[model samples]
Target: MEIPRRLPSQLPLILYLFFIILHTNVATTDTIKVGDWKEILNDTLVQDLGMYAVLRYNNSTGSNLSFYAVFEAQAQTVAGLNFRLALQALDADFPRLYKAYVWEKPWENFKNLTSFEPVLG
Candidate 1:
């Protein structure tokens, strides 16, 4: 078998380009910054999480807040999933916007309502 001498010259550039691309992709996968929440396009599970958050808030605070609907939702993946949901609820027949943050580890069957506050806007 005859070995080609011209192969070595092209191999280095190819390998360098390959590694550059590989590094870029790996870096992109972890580019989730703090407060970089992506919108939940159509996840019913996320909507359900929003409802759970409101219920938990009501139970703990003894506020009679009825869940109306989920307006906007976003999720950030960390050690678990952090769901930030903007939801509409009724308090004494008044519709208001509320922001709820729920952190959950589904595999461990753990969920925590980190924050739930009325959006003052």
Candidate 2:
């Protein structure tokens, strides 16, 4: 069998490129898949978080908003867990839609309202 003179020189470059491609794909896959939001079926925890979000917002803004019901919820895990909720509330006797982001560390008994904003049409 005859060996090509350039084969040895090209082998290292091919292996190096293959490894680089593999590493790049693994990293991208991890980053994209980590912390994906998942739907939460209605439960006690979801209800509590929904109420907590409204209560915190009302307290901070001094707005007389009352917690009504949570329409939908999703959760994501990060350093802590994040609760995203679409909830209904009463503002001056009219129902309104709200989006709330709550971050909670259950082990530490720590919870914070990250964002609360009314959803517009």
Candidate 3:
């Protein structure tokens, strides 16, 4: 007697099992952590009036990064002095992000003029 061959339904089941195994193997493999904001910003373009600094940390579970920037301009007269500061935060993949900008008014006794969301370049 001849043996019966597997039906088309078996093909989908076999493919599903193969994908499950492949995904499991990929998930179990060790993942290297890339957490260095200083290095990341070293290659970035710096603005003429702005200076930037970054701090980063990571562990086996996850990572966090923060960036700070201070922009200053000198004015010969009281009207020309202006200051702007920007701060940003991001995750390892940079999917989740936050940014803030602050303006300083020294004429008004060096008080914070306003705070707003920074526009991304």
Q: By lDDT, who's the top model here?
A: 2
lDDT of 3 by residue, 4-114 (tens): 888786999999999999999999985433321211122233332232222212222244453444332221222433333344445454633233222334457553333
What is residue 73's positional error in candidate 1, in angstroms? Answer: 1.7
- Candidate 1 lDDT (Cα, whole model)? 0.87
Local accuracy of candidate 1 as per-residue lDDT tens digits, 56-107: 9999999999988887888898888898888999999999999899998999
Evaluate model 3: give its TM-score.
Answer: 0.24
Worst 10 residues of 2 by lDDT: 26-35
Count of clashes, each model:
0, 0, 0
Q: How does candidate 3 score on lDDT?
A: 0.39
Determine which window of 10 residues in candidate 3 has minimal summed lDDT: 35-44
Off by over 4 Å in 1: 1-4, 19-36
Per-residue error for 49 in candidate 1, Å, reads 1.1
Regarding TM-score, does 2 or 3 come out ahead? 2
TM-score of each: 0.77, 0.72, 0.24
Better of 1 and 3 by TM-score: 1
